[model samples]
Target: MSLLEKQPNTSSEFEVDSQRRHEQDAHLDSKLRTLRLLDGARAGATLLALLMGLAVLGTTGHALQAYNTSRFDASAGGAAWLSMWPDNGAFDVKPTVALVVGASLVVLSNVIALTSHHRFVRARLAAAHTPLTFSAPFVGLVVAIVAVILFYVANQSATADTLLSWSCRWRFLNTASPAPQFASLCRASHAGVDLAILLIPVEFAAFVLAGFELKLQRYTAAYTHARKTPSPVLA
Candidate 1:
């Protein structure tokens, strides 16, 4: 071919290469965002759930232990048995149930995250840039809702216990006996028990937050795609 003809062909080939490179870069960028969703955020969520689950799991053991202890009653000491928690007796059920439910969700979150995000640690596809597929958002949504409900149930149980305990007579049943007094430390301990009981539910909330983060992940992915794709040109 003549030099002039070859020149035009080279120019055309160069343009094609440039377009191909641009598309490849855009594709790579999209995949990176997907990795961040699955690996970065999702992994973080899984870790959060695992940690929360461990915490609530420990509380479950403690609650079970407390169940074996004596119940507070009329003959009980004034400030010592003032926790006002289900552990005070076998009559309460909410806190125990809350502990189980929260732990279940924590396990579920970790399972979903690990199973879906396995590709991050091990390549499952021929193309390393392929984005990880996300499952339904409903799984996380249900977990989040149930977790919140259980959390409130536990809190409500604690509140009722506290009110009832406070109203109980703190006096010894004997001749010329007066109402017993609680020390400042005991008073703080009473409040501390109430707050400490809430820790399990709070950890459960963290588990739910990790689950709900998937919603944010979806929105972010959609926004990223929109920004990467060029707008349609009207002729």
Candidate 2:
């Protein structure tokens, strides 16, 4: 073909290539937008998990304090003998503390993952540089499982004993009785346990989303790099 004829063909080919690249870039941008929305959802789940954990800790602590106060009252003589929570004695505070710690750790790990993701998306950090981010989901998952086990043990301990009966004492006991206060405390304590159980799904969801986010982030990074890099020219 003549040089002038060949020039037109080359120009047409270049135009086609440019248009294809533009379309690819647009597709990647759409994927990134979807990823941002997913990240937002993950953060929301993590926040909810944190709130529920705090509620468990507060209600359980207040209940234990009230139960202890009841032990000092003479009118509620039998209240001291009542088992309103785990462990045979008045109430075992250790398990509750352990569960709270585990749950807190789970929330912390999720937060770390979310932070890492944000940094990565902003190009301020690389996924490889943040090793903790990769492991955060696993850590959160394991801790959540441990917290759930502790909750199950606590639930079993309370259910197997007279805990439920004591918690409901306010309904059966006279309103003038000092034991009603003890019953309220017992009920609150168990409510904390219930809250923890109810939050298990949320905790799992946060970790799951984190894991998915991590994988998607790596893929997106690779795709972006591949698209941006100049391909090897054939001689």
Candidate 3:
């Protein structure tokens, strides 16, 4: 028989070949979708990380400058301690407002990322969605959560007594001092800086986790899509 001649068994062979090709095409499409989502997530995460890193530096610098240059004073009856900023202080600082701005930037960056994800899903998966598509909305919810958590964490470092909270505790714990001491009274240089430093890592971890969650959503969508697509039909 000629190469193109129809054989009795050729119909079955052709169906199998077509099915395999269909599966391969479906899988390739899934991978491409996944890669696009992953790219968006990575870019957003990078920007968020940069903003948070700047926040860390700003908090540390504010704390250190206040410590080094601001005048630490106490009430006559020793009721309270205060760090009074000098207009001429070596480190001019605005921890609360600055941190708020930083937090806003973080929130903005995450919002843009999440919006991108949503648009992709609505445009691509809305019609032929699987149970996995429910995850489309759920995909970047973690980023919003991270933004809120980071905002609060940043707030801690910006608060007035944040450093003093740990400073007094440290003096009471490690020093011979039996009484709780205000930052001015204790003169502990490290003070709340340690807590601020510790939170930096926690902030970093939150962003990292958010990125992973985005990836998880993308991979799951791809898998579900591949599984749902029908194989090629036999003639």
**Best candidate (score: TM-score):** 2
Q: Count the backbone clashes (under 3 Å) in each candidate.
A: 0, 0, 1
Residues 1-235, model 1: lDDT tens digits = 5998899899999999799778877876776666465456545645555555555555543444333332333236554444433343534445445545655665565555555556654455423222222332234335545654664565465434432133222322221212223232133323323433444344344344444455555566686677689879899
Q: TM-scores of the models, in the given order?
A: 0.47, 0.73, 0.35
| lDDT, model 3, position 86 | 22
Q: Per-residue lDDT for 135 in model 2?
A: 67
Deviation in angstroms for 207 in model 3? Answer: 7.4
Single out the weakest 10-residue window by summed lDDT for candidate 1. Answer: 171-180
Model 3 ranges off by over 4 Å: 1-6, 71-162, 166-235
Q: Rank the candidates by TM-score, best first.
A: 2, 1, 3
Candidate 2: segments with Cα more than 4 A from true spot: 69-98, 107-138, 154-165, 169-171, 174-180
Model 2 scores a TM of: 0.73
Question: Candidate 3 clashing pairs?
Answer: 163-192
Q: Tens digit of lDDT per residue, candidate 2, span 118-193?
A: 7555476663424555466567667767766875676456434333345555434444454436456566767776
TM-score of 1: 0.47
- Listed per candidate, the RMSD to the true structure in angstroms reads 9.4, 4.6, 11.3
How much is the lDDT of residue 200 in candidate 2? 72
Per-residue accuracy of model 3 over 85-192 as CA lDDT, tens digit each: 223332223433343344445445444444544667657765533233223223333433453455346436533443333444444443222223434423432322
Pairs of residues at least 3 apart in sequence or in different chains that clash in candidate 2: none
